[model samples]
Target: MNKPLVVMLGGSGFVGRHLAPRLVAAGYRVRVPSRNRNMARDVGCVPGVELVNCNVHDPAELRRVLEGASVAINLVGILNESGHGGAGFNRAHVELTRNLIGACKEAGVGRLLQMSALNAGRGTSHYLRTRGEAEQLVRQSGLAYTIFQPSVIFGRGDGLFGRFALLLRFAPVLPLARASARFAPVYVGDVADAFLAAMSRKDTVGQVIELYGDEVLTLKQIVEYTARCMGLKRLIVPLPDALARIQALVFDFVPGKPFSSDNYRSLKLDSVGGVDGLHRLGIAKTPIDAVVPKLLGEAGRQTLLDRNRRVR
Candidate 1:
């Protein structure tokens, strides 16, 4: 029997960067199609991996990439608002998914693996709601599919934890948005492993699996913890929901702005997954504290510089 070919979208992003190598290690040949092929070449450099440049939202381009792929993983998502490029969550989360499903169907891709979020649900913020809708569309596509809805993923290359670490260094006082809301920040490597497992396991098809860290902590707790790990002395001031939402709104108007009201809503709910799925999937959630020190390292200038340089 031959190993299946996995076609990955948005492989240049944080999760995809970690996932590409892990998939290769698991004996699957990976193909990542991105808009900028040169930038994505790193993904292809993984043994048994290929890279292509294509617009995932275009049905024809999607089909071209889907050719000969046994499974397709859609990992494309935008955190900040971008002008003209249509970085809105609705297009990337909903419309792109719709197009991918259609292209998969057309190209006869055998399976679809969707990377989603743990807090995705009705009445949640637009981020969560859009993610929920994308899941619904995937489920209804009449294809063999598995969904991995993970909490805010953290690791060496992850944005969630790394962003907090960056903020703590420059600012002596942390203005926390949704400080009361909680999360179960999963390690990036664990989440990537879960994706590989879902692709190969029969029981994973057509199931929505949620993933989380071993423990839960509030937004404020995570910020404080990250600061403490970096050996920074900082004060955390919890901002009211209204103020946070307004801050997000203001930032949304600026290009490449990281904060927004949608993000505020996303943080309002707990990110921990119900543990039943973890048990069923035969995965033991990795704890956040166990891995933080390794990734962030002891307080040092070189480590901070390395992290900051990666951001640009």
Candidate 2:
């Protein structure tokens, strides 16, 4: 019997890095479309995974990639503002979803997993509002699709908590925004597993599942947890909402502006997943504390935790 084929869009990213191997292990042939094919070359040796270069925004190219695939997963998203002066987060989040859905329908792809974010429907911020709109489009696309709405994803190579870990090593005090906005950050590995579950089960088709960590915490609490787990002595200073906006505005022009005015706006919204979908999926959540020590270096982990205990 031939294995099913699953074409994955945005396969070079953090989530993709974790997901590709799982799919290959399950006897499914995986094809990845990335701008820089070389970044994904390591995946080529994983049994049946292939890589190709294609522009995600181009419908024709997307269709070509989607052709004859039993399943497709779209994981493309940009957190920072685009330099093209083009569509902001709104277009990248909502408009691109519309384009991908149409392309998938034309290519006759039967199964799709649309990746979305938690707390996305209430229009909390421009970013979240756009995410909500995109979810609505997918829900009404008439395709058998599974939506994976995950909270902030963290892992060894994650862009979220990992970056903070790096900063705590050098910076004396960590200045953060919306420290009160709570999150139940899901692990990248768990997120990948959720995708695999969605791919294998027809029951997941046309369903929306939310992924989250076992622990719910504020932004400051997460930073503290990471610092403690890494064994670091650092002070976490919470910037007021207004001041955080100013800081983000000042740093907007910085290269790799992961922190920006728009990002600050997004922090105002709580990032926990709702029970409506999470309970139905039966996917248990992993807390950030359980895995931080493993991902952090031994020395750093000891130092941070030692310092954290003293401070507390």
Candidate 3:
């Protein structure tokens, strides 16, 4: 018996790292297309996963990747762009989705699983605006599609907790922006399970699932929780909106763009979900306490070991 081929567009990213393995374990063959195969080496190492060197943004390349595949999963997204203009966001989110839709139809692909964010179409930021645009394209494409809109996701090696943990280790006091913004963080594994469950269920088609955790915490509270997990007592100063905007403007030019004006704009809307997608999908939400503390402890121990080795 031949297994169905699942083409994962952004299988090299954070969520993809967790989902790809589950697809393989479920007896599906996964094909991941990346511009640089070297960067996706980890995803490629999974059994029944294939990594192809190709530019997914290119319509021709996208069609080639989707050819003869039963399902296509688009997880491609960018939090920030090179410039202040929304051109980069449009290119990555809207344009790529449009291209993927056309490619799916031409290649006879039956299903699509799109990854999106909460409050996607409601914000003034380019990130959310383009996300909404992409969703529209998927809805009108006439293909069997399932859109997964999740709040900020947290887990091992995640950007949320991991990034803050790194910062709390060095900075005595952190000036946070949008400190009142709230989010119900979802687990990476539960999100993967959502996709897996949606794959075979006909009812999931044409539905938008909002995945979120059980706990709703403010941005300030999230940082405080991160610090406590690390056993560190640090001052977290919440900046007023004016000061936060200025801080974002300053970091816009900083290397790697730790924060941006667009981010501040997105934070204007809470990332909390109205409906529970995990529970609806029959998957229990994994609490942060169940995962973060252990991951942080391991990371802290590793960091201490490295620091001690350097000192010696």
What is the lDDT of every predicted structure here? 0.80, 0.80, 0.93
lDDT for each residue of candidate 1 in 1-312, tens digit (9 for 90 to 100): 777788998887788988898888888888888788778766767777788878888889999999888999988877644552334778889999999999999989979999888867655566777788899999899999998888788888677667888777778897878888888778787777788878778988889888887778888888888877887778999988778878777877866676776677677677777854666767776777788876666543555676689998
Query: lDDT, candidate 3, residue 161?
Result: 90
**How many residue pairs clash in each candidate at the backbone level?**
0, 8, 0
Task: Sort the candidates on lDDT, descending order.
Answer: 3, 1, 2
Model 2 agreement with the true structure over 224-265: per-residue lDDT tens digits: 877877777789999987788888887788888858776777
lDDT of 2 at 89: 73
lDDT of 2 at 240: 83
- Please write out the lDDT profile of model 3 over residues 86-121, one tens digit for every residue: 999999999999999999999999799999999989
TM-score of each: 0.90, 0.89, 0.97
* RMSD vs true structure, all candidates: 3.6, 4.3, 1.2
Lowest lDDT block of 10, candidate 3: 298-307
Index of the highest-TM-score prediction: 3
Candidate 1 vs 3: which has more lDDT: 3
